[model samples]
Target: QYRLQYKMTVREELYRQIKAHLDLIGINAADELFIFDGEADAEVYNRAVKHVDLWNHNVEFLEQETPWERPAVFIEFQPIKWKAIVTGVEYRADVFANLHVVTDWNEGDGIGEFQLLEKIHEVLAGLCGSNFMEFDIDTSMTNHNHEEVVENIETYHCIGFRHLK
Candidate 1:
């Protein structure tokens, strides 16, 4: 299974910009916007490519968020998968790794880059799997409190498992 949490702040126009880009890429609003689940290795790679393509299209938005700010996105890939027991015996384990990408958009003298990076490291340490859960964190300006704002981040959690009896 793979999961992802994405956070970002953009002007209404920018939001429209992103939507337009998505449309241009043929990703319809009705499409499964979140939770990309797949069973095959090729499927997994395709899903990740889709997300990266979207991000590339909106790379300008990140740049606009902070003037003269170079925000680098880092993703930690963690793979996890489920196994089934058959004939009173357990079969081989299915493996996957979760992907966690964290960056700083604090835009102040609060925390150092390394410190922010460490926060994600701590979070990734707790996750285990070969099926990756990918998370994209955009810590930018917001009207809501820290916890509330963090919760608002869009997350795409996916699972790819098959058990046969």
Candidate 2:
């Protein structure tokens, strides 16, 4: 299992409420979402995707169809904000999970780069998970060339989890 972390700046009361809900749903106090049973990396990613999807679906339904029974929009917004935070954590988890699998495929050799990319694409397609439109692996320079390296980097079709809503 992987441990994910997401930092949020919010009031203590609201944070406590959010933490309570997360706990109620089985998320840990450490903000770690566990992947049980030694599941494959792809399986873990799929589970994370499902968890977010279900939460969002329930929130949408409650907001639209049963608004009266729930807190007012303003109050509910606090939890929504926290949900977004959790979703962002999940997104990062998915990316890093794929990266770990890819890098491990060939002992981090450059030879398996293409195969790793293919595996990422396959997992994303099959799970209907967040779209990872593009990514790049840099081998040209180390941390010493930070300034020069930034110029050579490329990013495309990388949508933020916020926009997915």
Best by lDDT: 1
List runs of model 2 lying over 4 Å from the truth.
Answer: 1-110, 125-165
Q: By TM-score, who's the top model here?
A: 1
Instruction: State residue 150's C-alpha deviation in candidate 1, in Å.
Output: 20
* Residues 16-84, model 1: lDDT tens digits: 332232222221244222222334433433221122112331233443543222223322223443455
Cα lDDT, model 2, residue 38: 40
Instruction: Give the distance in Å from residue 26's predicted Cα in candidate 2 to where it truly belongs.
Output: 26
Model 1, residue 27: distance off in Å is 35
TM-score per candidate, chains pooled: 0.23, 0.19
lDDT of each: 0.29, 0.26
* Candidate 1 structure, TM-score to reference: 0.23
Span of 10 residues, lowest total lDDT, candidate 1: 147-156
**Candidate 2: C-alpha RMSD after superposition:** 20.1
- Expressed as tens digits, the lDDT of each residue in 122-162 for candidate 2 is 33332222333232232221111222111111111222233
Question: Cα lDDT of model 1 overall?
Answer: 0.29
